[model samples]
Target: MNPLRILLLCHSFNSLSQRLFAELRAHGHTLSVELDIADSVTEEAVALFRPDLVLAPFLKRRIPPTVWQRVTCLVVHPGPPGDQGPSALDWAVWRGEPHWGVTVLQANGDFDAGPVWAHASFDMRPATKGSLYRREVTQAAWRATLAAVQRFAGGERSAPALPDDAPLVRWQPLLRQSERAIHWATESTTSVLAKLRSGDGQPGVLDTLWGQACYLGDAHPASAAAMAEFSDAEPGAMLAVREGALLRCTVDGGVWIGQARRADPPDTHPTQRSFKQVAAELFATEAAGLPQRPVPLQRSPDEWGELRYTEHGPEGARVGCLGFDFYNGAMSTARCERLRAALLQVRERPTKVLLLLGGEGFFSNGIDLNSIEAAAHRPGDSAADASWRNIQAMNDVALAVLQTTDRLTVSVLRGNAGAGGAFLALAADQVWAHGSVVLNPHYKNMGNLYGSEYWTYLLPRRLGDAGAKALMTQRLPLLAAEALKIGLLDHNDEGSRQGFEERSLERALALASSYNQSGELAAKQARREQDEAHRPLALYREQELARMHRNFYGFDPSYHVARHHFVHKQPHAWTPRHLAVHRP
Candidate 1:
């Protein structure tokens, strides 16, 4: 293919754009650089370049339609075809997408909507926003530019029109200060870790020390795991230390202290202190925020919405999963109520099987423990009663799954399920887990009840009474294979269950097409049997589970021994578990 003259429009002479310019020049193409595309200079720059094609690698300003029409202006979007917009990289990182790439296409007046040219894709790794761009995206963009150029020059530029059926690429707005508030009482360790990773090496994770804003640097999952395990320490307490690595704490553990500044210097050893000392100080500060008076639960507007489903056939129904993942704070009573409403709306359809297909790697992370703790601390509030009610609300949703008629609810577990999270998956008539998935009731580890309200009912029903007791007491995690053996999961074939529900949905529709009569009666009968079989066990379990939780929290250890480790000059060998067992 013969080389074509190219004009590169970029926001800055940054490393990414600079590299692209070098590659285009090395490919023997005539290249001109336009560093800025302000309204005044854009036209003049385009006219001056007078090249066959204009490529914008990281240009901030939108290219005018006239300029794009005159020259074959192409925009290299760092996302999937439909996902074209500003800050695609940031959004992808925030959403924890596993795949990301660059799409080089015609730059039309409409933001990222343009005819296809070529794309280079890559898998998303555990990387920060800046690191991800530097490693995967920058190189992919360069490759895409060359490919597009080659196709255009070889007279093989075929316009693949954007599909109308493609899902609109969801855009995430820039993170706001309010959104960054570290609500220790509301967020889970996993979610907090993701937030830290998303903001790694940038603005940094928002944290407060002595009411002053502090930025915590990027922490890996393993490091966060260490910190979460020691969460028995007081909120904001540093419990452990990894040498020259991180100070593990309660709320935001595994945080690398990138930069610390205050009106007053933090009282410490001046240099690096042990994890216990850090935890003690931080805990004291957090404890001071607790109200002497009861704090009322401030109700917020219900921010939950459901997908509008449409009937596919006489005996078939289709609802888009839309990739809903219930994170740590997602299981509030308000959200549960909204989910109940949504489930009811979909359950009305004359469908045989209700398949939850999306939310890969997460089913639900269970009720927000932080929220329960917060409500419990409020003055004039019956924290104990509130906690019980919240658990009941969660259990209700699980029980509803068992009682739903006219459809066999099948949970396709594509990732980790734990605590109420695991029970949510178990509530379904049948659970199909991907090979690498894990199921565990982790409440015991967190010093909470064995399982929430549904555990009483669902656990013994699936696993015999003896099995449920063993699981609850041991707090052992079950891998997918083991979970299948224990009857927790019905099917666990890695390949066959890869996209079981989706593939089965297609097959169901085909069968529905040939149905001489409604299969609604059969579905209802099946649901009735399940409800009857489980109702007695669920009631008994609910009582026992509540008793377990009350007992657990009543004897809650106040001062964390791990925090003691950091307080005293103890070796890092004292794991969080050691301290937790000896808690006073």
Candidate 2:
């Protein structure tokens, strides 16, 4: 099929949109992005870009008839054929549907009732709505969208009619907070989990904790042993606090509620209405009264945690795998400190190689903006101070990675990475990622943040001066294959997420047992010494932090303003010029 001009219309350039953009561009399509700001603005974009097709990967509003009638428009609905709704995933998850899918259909007067162009389905997994959408929904949507786009590119304008058995009007209304409310006293652990998972990451299950109204989410089932210990506790009773989560007993078992947002009164200012934060932090006073239950850094698979360490292979050739699965890959000051401590501890192990497998769905996304925003409300803390502390903690983690010269350190990106996280990967001797991983290596999008994860020292060495400068300004997502073609990635493998994990482990073991492992380590040490002599790492850090200090404490409020909007989930007023190519 000949490549065609495509305009991506989305509510926000979310993960799905970024993946579509990267994949479509890789297929040689001329693409532009226009946020679904307003009907008139979208019409103007259609006039300017004159795209052959408009692909709506993620949108809350329907496309205007004036634009869809003039050009072929494909709406990527996150549902199977005949499923029409704004909250398809939420409903599917809440009901524990065995299967779900993505459908590519032509834009029509009725929402999600258009002629089906393509559809792809996947067996449902027990996970949060956000997790399902990021993984299964994204992959299925890409496949279906690609097929639909190909059909259009091949001059197939007409879509086949829907089956006669199809419902004439199967519209599932948006799932409301009332539907997601949890009944702690009556519901079992599994039931409570379903309610929380369905609303995880947005409009979390509205509930009262410690007599204060709040939205609950990021729940995990307590271990069987832990639940057994709390079996006698009254249902709905807060049992304990562990790793920043609150464990509450259920009728059958117990669950750890990891995150929450305060449901402030309507009279409260929007800015003061809390965004999601660690549940323990959100209700710090109450959590303090509960007993603290800390788990070992290495534990059973049934246990839940943000960080875990495991050793592979025998004695001398052993490989250490440290996985840090932070929620949404947001590293607050505390998380960074925890990660740094884990890195240091893992280094002490008698292992020749260390694998840093960062989270599912995201490797890391730099400093936690939400945490910093919440800091503003704390009694003695300010956002600026919190930002400084978080960045420094992040820098400390990167530095620890850089200093691990004795072992062969590998940063395996099992998921997407952006901003300082991208550079943090470079701190390792080699960076590996699967083909599906997307990397946003620049931090300008977060209010022109001059990032400080030793990127000045790490990036320039990887891509040289000019290439590094160019990448810092590109402000675009780079696919793993393209990253390998350039110097951004050392290795890229094509495989499913599970396959990638297996292969990455195999590769890491191979590196650990390499014939010239000692020689490679020596060479690495020598180069580090030479680089240190040429320009101290501290100098690079100092220079980077100088610029970052301005971003955090300087006159320009762009970083703070952007952070507030992002944490608050504010709707976009206009598309960024970099994304909306039709704009001046």
**Candidate 1 TM-score over all chains jointly:** 0.46
Cα lDDT of model 2 by residue, 324-365, tens digit: 888888999999998999999888889999999998778898
TM-score to true structure, per model:
0.46, 0.98
Q: Which lDDT values do the candidates have, in the order given?
A: 0.57, 0.91
Per-residue lDDT of 259-339 in model 1, one digit per residue for the tens? Answer: 222222467552233111112122445534432211111111221112223244452444223123333223656446656
Poorly placed runs, candidate 2 (over 4 Å): 161-169, 267-272
Q: Which window of 10 residues has the lowest lDDT sum in candidate 1?
A: 294-303
The true-versus-predicted C-alpha distance at residue 177 of model 2, in Å, is 2.2
Model 2: which ten-residue window has the lowest total lDDT?
Answer: 160-169
- lDDT score, candidate 2: 0.91
